[model samples]
Target: MTTRVATETFPMPDGSLGARLTMTAGRANSLEPGLLGDLASALDEAEAQDTSAILICGGRNFSSGGDVRAFHRASLDGEAVAYANAVVPRLQAIVGRLIAMPRLVVVAARGAVTGGSAGLLFAADLAVLAPDAFVQPYYAKVGFAPDGGWTALLPERIGAGRTLEWLQSDRRLDASALCDAGLATAVSDTPEMTAARLAAEGEIGTRLATKALVWDEARRARINARLEAETAAFLERIVQPDTALGMSRFIERIGS
Candidate 1:
């Protein structure tokens, strides 16, 4: 197993809290199980501090989603089902927490954000992407259905029809397309700095109030249900012959 680094939290100058994901090695910050636990703990610490806003920043690629190579290895070891069942639920829980957070949430991402990592864009109240950043829905390519709230939250941003089309196309969405589709608040050369400035300048009370008005318990419940269904379906599909073949090919490509 790869060594896991905890999420680091820093006090921002503007009275907000900043959280940086420290797990950037291997497959562009892939979502390892330990990283997920660190993320959840970091969020809890941020809330405990009563920070006015929360800023999440990542490495060069923000995240490349779950580690496909790890999945392939697990499959070869005959542990794919157990791996998916353990990881997907934790991913869903983290996504749920992000959606239900009381304070403002902001994300600054660069490089390729795909798979489960792309779901973070939708859960965030505001997201800033670097000019070179791209979002890719990689589930279809891997022969797994979307999970981590992608199916539920993406449609709210880009509409059901467009989201379905985009998912099926298996294409990467550039910064401009993400901004135009309402998934990104802005596309900037310095996305992390821009996100910090925006969080500092915005009125905390108003932003929190607006979020409260827009997001309610019932909607959250629906999202949770959808996440559960997606996770279950993905676990079932990933063990099939086609998905196994697809995963093996992906591992080969990455290895080469």
Candidate 2:
């Protein structure tokens, strides 16, 4: 229950330890620069620890994605492009690290996990969701290019065609749909506990090796390259004439 780096150690079934990184950004965890920095630090600590797994969960709504309202404001001020440049790289880097981490990475999310934040679920070795939770991509809705592996890594879970279809329209994938699409390991009311329990299973060495084999060096390289492409796309799209209007409309629609 510690908030400092949000690293709470859990004893695993095979007598090893695990680290849980809790997202405590209250009321729809918005991915601000500071929050992203904190998440990067937590991942830093988790990577350095001698643990078998990392469980990422918590926050009222696991995350409402990026601070779109703030992004909208910055757009009006002509700083949206710069803001996207600063934030997209850091967020994508975190996703890269999750994919390359030497141990298991597990995510348990509730409520809204949208935009680039959904990459956490995509990059995880296992992801559990609360039944009522949903995953969405608002890029088309907000006229932003996809970031956070919505293109690069998500296709690895649900395929490219589905990823394209989902992004081009207004739709949210509920937990059951996510599980069916192979984007989630399971759905549960107690997603945090479910994820922690799954993370605690299996031997540490075996789990680590399994993760490495699946997320091998070549695959990691490809993902990183795609993430860079996503970053570039996001920066370009955020500064376009359509983005300000899109953001304003979406912001008013969501009442965020």
Candidate 3:
């Protein structure tokens, strides 16, 4: 498989190390099977270098979530369950690692960010949202349950009742609305530039300490449990006839 993520390092003005992870493969920067390994490799490099901050960005959109086309194809091949089992665990592990990272991590989001990609935004210590950025709770629309720590992270950011309502309604939230709801750190026309600047300028030691304090052992344990449950639910749902129908409708809608 081709590598979807690109990592690079740059020296900060203050002599701190900076790293970037860019998602390069797939039209919508869709998360695929090897993405976790790619991200882990970047994280490993950052950690080894004692990087002060890491910025994650994507081409066009931050991410459109999982590869629905891939899922549909797998469904037809009677391999959807196998695909899910392979990818979902890796996603869980990566999210866990992000939360546990000892340095600052930020997301620079633009265009459509949905499903598992939206869940990834939650793992970031901060997120910079472009003016054109939007978030979609895409699982229900695709007949899959939430994954990538969505169950554990979103409620805390937006409140449980509101999160539940949003998931069921499948509402799309724009950058302004997300920032208003406290889910996004800032809204800017130049989100990537802003995120990169922040990553370079922010107080690294304080940010690392804050991250460590916020995502403690108990929180990590809870997130792990939720991820496991989400994977189980998703595997069950993906193979269902209704899920296939939903996915088909989604594809047709997009095609039309």
Q: Which TM-score value belongs to model 3?
A: 0.94
Give the candidate number with the greatest TM-score: 2
TM-score (C-alpha, index-matched) for candidate 2: 0.95
Question: Can you write out model 3's per-residue Cα lDDT over 18-58, one digit (the tens) per residue?
Answer: 88889886658777877766877778888999888888888
Give one clash count per candidate, in the order shown. Answer: 0, 0, 0
lDDT-based ranking, best first? 2, 3, 1
- Please tell me which model should have the higher TM-score, number 1 or number 3: 3
User: Model 3: residues >4 Å from true position, as ranges?
Assistant: none
Alpha-carbon shift of residue 188 in model 1 (angstroms): 1.6
Superposed by TM-score, candidate 2 places the C-alpha of residue 53 at a distance from the truth, in angstroms, of 0.5
Candidate 2 residue-wise lDDT at 194:
92
Best by lDDT: 2
Order the candidates by TM-score, highest first: 2, 3, 1
Candidate 2 clashing pairs, residues 3+ apart or interchain = none
lDDT per residue (tens digit) for residues 1-256 in model 1: 4444445565655656666444455667788787777677777777777776777777788888888877878888899988887678888898888878887788899998889888777898898999999988888878877887778777766788998898899888899999888888998888988987777665677888888777788888888888888888988987888998988877777774
Predicted candidate 2 versus true structure: per-residue lDDT over 1-256, tens digit per residue: 3342366888888887789998887547777787788889887777677777899986658887888888888888889878887788999999999989888999998888988889888999999999788988988888889989998898877788988899988589999999998888999989999999888776778888988998899998988999999999988888888988898889889784
**By lDDT, is 2 or 3 better?**
2
